[model samples]
Target: MKAATAVAVVVAVAVTLGMVATLAEAGDNNRVFQPCADAKIQRGDGFTFGIAFSTRESFFFNQTQLSPCDRRLSLASGANAQLALFRPKVDEISLLTVNTTSYPAVTNGGFMVAFAGRKYAARSLPAFVSNSSYTVTSFTLVLEFQKGTLQNLYWKRDGCASCSGKSNFVCLNKQECAIKTSNCKSANQGGSVDCSIGIQLAFSGTDKHDAVLNSWYEVSNLQQYSLYGLYSNLRNSLTSQYNKIF
Candidate 1:
């Protein structure tokens, strides 16, 4: 009876170890995406923003698409707020260059831009991996901005000629960038000016699976602590409400 009991104990231990190994494998397959390091901004005659990310698994994938007016960041100084908009072209904007050896090739990419309340929103195209259980790491985003001209100007959401609804104009010049909105028809006129600004952006992909990804605009030469504080307050308020319900 002792020998039989010993044999049964060995069998049970083997089964338990097998189960643990399987569970660990499963856990490894579903690892979440890690955040990239905070981007560093350098200011001179122009600006450059660098972003990075990392993953453990070999079969990771990541893709980022940016559009003109897809992301906006704002800064508030007491009663005044400064907003910056990032707008990349839909077809020519290449933010991420994929490495076929390290990561699976990207399938699709593009960008779109829009004007919102006191801000311009830029959006990136969706990114995903063809296979599961892969982690993408060490992705980078580099954006270069200099002075250039933007033409064929028109109102973002309204017909330039009709001017029946709300009207706003965002103009970028050599010295400064400005947005003006007015309710009167006289203010709705559309024209192009010599904008001494040029912008270029690039990004890479990761293995995480999110259908839509958003790239926030980085505001240069502005202090945005107040904006961040307000955002933190709003997030905390929502979290508190959720906790109360749960």
Candidate 2:
């Protein structure tokens, strides 16, 4: 009986490793990772982008706070229900703005960058505090490409440009314009404030055609939510099956 039990354990471990290897090998094909179907995009084309949110402490990678492209890695404590994704048509230098869904409350908040492939994820950014002191609402995401393939994603600060003249805002280190969380809180104990984060998207470098790309745009005209549902469904399905193997 002991030998049989040992054999069973070994088989289980082998199966788990095999599953992980299979998933990793298939990672690039995952819709959540490559939503454009590996289509060659150019100026005037659109692609899906990802924003992963979690506690500030979880944003670190190798001691650097940057975004992670792997959804599994970006998850906080193995799961983060608060992920924002969008598809923007970037044709010219413009500002693409996106606001995340509201959270019930915040203790420590931050965000990591993610994009169309498994290879790209910028450093994470901190947005909220545990004391509810302030929240950084405005941000810029710069997409850098090398000869049409994406290479890196960067976070840019506005030096408090938008927060200027706002009574409820503050500037950190002459950059990072932040809104006071105190004003966001309601008198009710359950009131949620400073929960939303806004990000602006911009592009640089060239597409496959080597055409100079635009910088920013608004998220109003972009596609969202629907594709995310499909992504979530696929992810859940895979996870459910994997868990059952145990």
Candidate 3:
């Protein structure tokens, strides 16, 4: 599988990680690193989520989702469910920039956010792109997923970010990511443009990356915790951005 798909698969596993959120965040990133490790968390704390893409015809898709966002955005197939979480501890990180160069090296808690392709490119408010200067786009966050075994983690949503290019080029820095518009294109709306939903962050750090990953099991259980955090972070990001724009 391609790197994006592999990581996207990681996002799909969030379903299982729902039960493992408590295990992953009991105290540090170290606790939730094992692939088979259980989150021991509960539903509504660390689960998956879905966001609709903008109306097709938004020109922002060109630089964001890596696809066209000019069509009838599909619904996030499994989005009916989502986890509920509060803010994450992103302020502590030295360089939380989501760039092509940095995203590959992210670790601890970066790689879990994604969106649908048929509708929005990465279908979140903060990440949406627009061509019009005044047509500022914002985020629209949904609820969080329930914590439990990832029984429903592997299915595609109705309006999921299609794996056509299977990669989103947009990246966000901790500081500017909040203000950043989801619209990558100059036009706020376009036609047949696909939404985007892919890795928000990823890392390859050692066990010492954070207070969470002290144990080897933490490293091994990557999918469980990472998936929960990914969607959780996305919802937070979108909510924050929506408040800012409105």
Candidate 4:
């Protein structure tokens, strides 16, 4: 791939998979798209966030098709939640849970992004993951900020799906830096969301979700408490709910 094209692939992957938009990807570019309309949305409703059993991030990567975010994160968030609730464990294993239906699965017991299983509600609560056997050792509960009309999302991946390893080869020269990205695609199609007008505004803001994954791996960052930065939004929600009851 050429330099700019290579950069686009990287940024595009980051755009779809990682929640936060890499500063490099948010260049002097813009997307001119015809707004999406939905059956549940009233004509006057400027932005429509279609809720369902779950969200599939697969189409998010198809920049050409017009799905927001990619098969990366938000797509997996819904199915991960289902896995958390159904088997509600945290151990590691093989089968990766993904969404089978589009976002409109709201009527059904949350769409089965992947696998045939039970259902759950997507309350404004935080996100979490568990083992197929039953445990919460590494539970990741992300609280959504319903503050913005824009739909921010969470995605999940099966720990045992065999993630690609980062192989740092000994490249003798700079010209040999043609390393390939994971280039994974979401395993779904169709279903569209009607986002409101305000827009993330900046197109590419700090809302990137790589922080969520990094936290999962127990990495450190410029923020003080790990929860303070990437998870502040979710932690606050937990605190608010706690204060209300106790």
lDDT of each: 0.19, 0.43, 0.24, 0.20
lDDT of 1 by residue, 1-246 (tens): 111111111110001111211222322432211111111111111111111111111111233322222222111111111112222221122222222221112211111121111122122222221122221111112232111111112111111221123123222222122223111111122222211111223221211231111221332111211122332232232112222322
As for model 2, its CA RMSD to the true structure in angstroms is 14.5
Candidate 3 accuracy as lDDT: 0.24
User: Best lDDT goes to which candidate?
Assistant: 2
List runs of model 2 lying over 4 Å from the truth: 1-39, 61-67, 71-81, 93-101, 105-108, 119-131, 185-195, 216-246
Model 4 TM-score on a 0 to 1 scale: 0.17
The model with the greatest TM-score is 2
Model 4 over residues 150-225: C-alpha lDDT tens digits? 2333333223211124232112122111111111111232212110000011111112222111222322211111
Best-to-worst order by lDDT is: 2, 3, 4, 1
User: What's the C-alpha lDDT at position 37 in model 3?
Assistant: 28
Which of the two candidates, 1 or 2, achieves a greater lDDT against the reference? 2
lDDT for each residue of candidate 3 in 69-187, tens digit (9 for 90 to 100): 22322212222112112212111111011211111111111112223222212323323322222111212122112222222112111222211222322222221121222332212
